[model samples]
Target: MSKKGKEKEEETMTFKLETAPFDPRFPNTNQTKYCYQSYIDFHRCRRIRGEKYEPCNYFKKVFTSMCPNAWVEKWNDQIENGTFPGRI
Candidate 1:
């Protein structure tokens, strides 16, 4: 019973998502980002802070606060290639 009020607050970041431009190939309108937005935002903020932080295991969860598709894609690709540990 005492544990209920003692839950910890985890720090998190927000990502702003951009709608995909109209493309003739895909007529159906849709909201899409090259990479997960949450990853970009959290990673950027964490890196800027520059200190030991609890590592986030999940990096592919999409959020509406991502920076930009291009930016996120660049980092995501690099991570997949093993250029970096992982995205935020």
Candidate 2:
């Protein structure tokens, strides 16, 4: 492969994937509440701190890793339509 192509591959490979760390609040094997809380916290953070706030991404990453894709999509739609059950 060309040097440029190798460099591009290396750049993509540099990313590190991780799941949400263990939290004392949710010690059981079931992480549903943890995932949901992260989702709520992410939106709340965004609402209070604005979309550009970097810390908000931490919650986003946690929820995205822990919640199922369909759940995330439904929650996103609910938030858009002002139907989300959780307070933000």
Candidate 3:
């Protein structure tokens, strides 16, 4: 594909949180499965130095202290793999 075409495709891509009735089978480890919008909000806040630092609080609460090392591992895996099952 042409570079222009690829750029257009990337621009058109919409990253949205997939929503449905919460799956009891879903592992809470997948940050993408929970309130995904919330995740995005938190992530952005941290990146932009937004006034609200608490946006990513859920991430810290659930992933950081709860399973600290695992969170880093998951992030590394996502970086290597391009996309994870839940988190974009």
Candidate 4:
């Protein structure tokens, strides 16, 4: 196959986007707490299990999909600055 053909094939390939699955603990319509919790859980899991642990990716995916980009950015900044409100 030609380079252009392979590139076109890659571009045309479909990738599905998914949101976090439902959790009974956060059954309410509002998912604010769910998002926040996932964020904290992700960091906590990383701290406890180390960065290479695969399960921690789940929490990261959940928060990234559910939380607003701006909120995630702010929280990331807070974490970097050691001012994140949640205990992680």
lDDT of 1 by residue, 1-88 (tens): 3554444322234466554334354344343432344465556656675445444323223332324567667766887787865454
Better of 1 and 2 by TM-score: 2
Selected candidate, larger lDDT, 2 vs 3: 2
lDDT of each residue in 1-88, candidate 2, tens digit only: 9999999988887767899999999999999999999999998999999999999999999999999999999999998999988898
lDDT of 3 by residue, 1-88 (tens): 9999999999999796533344465557564534444344455566676546775565444434333476557765875787754443
Query: Which ranges in model 3 have alpha carbons more than 4 Å from their true place?
Result: 1-52
* lDDT (0 to 1) per candidate: 0.48, 0.96, 0.55, 0.96
The worst-scoring run of ten residues by lDDT in candidate 1 lies at: 57-66
Question: Model 4, range 6-44, lDDT digits (tens) per residue?
Answer: 999999998998999999999999999999999999999
The TM-score values for the models, in the order shown, are 0.27, 0.83, 0.30, 0.85
- Best by lDDT, which number? 4
Clashes of each: 5, 0, 0, 0
Residue 43, candidate 1: alpha-carbon lDDT: 68
Off by over 4 Å in 2: 1-15
lDDT of 2 at 62: 98
Instruction: Locate the minimum summed-lDDT window of 10 residues in model 2.
Output: 8-17
TM-score of 3: 0.30
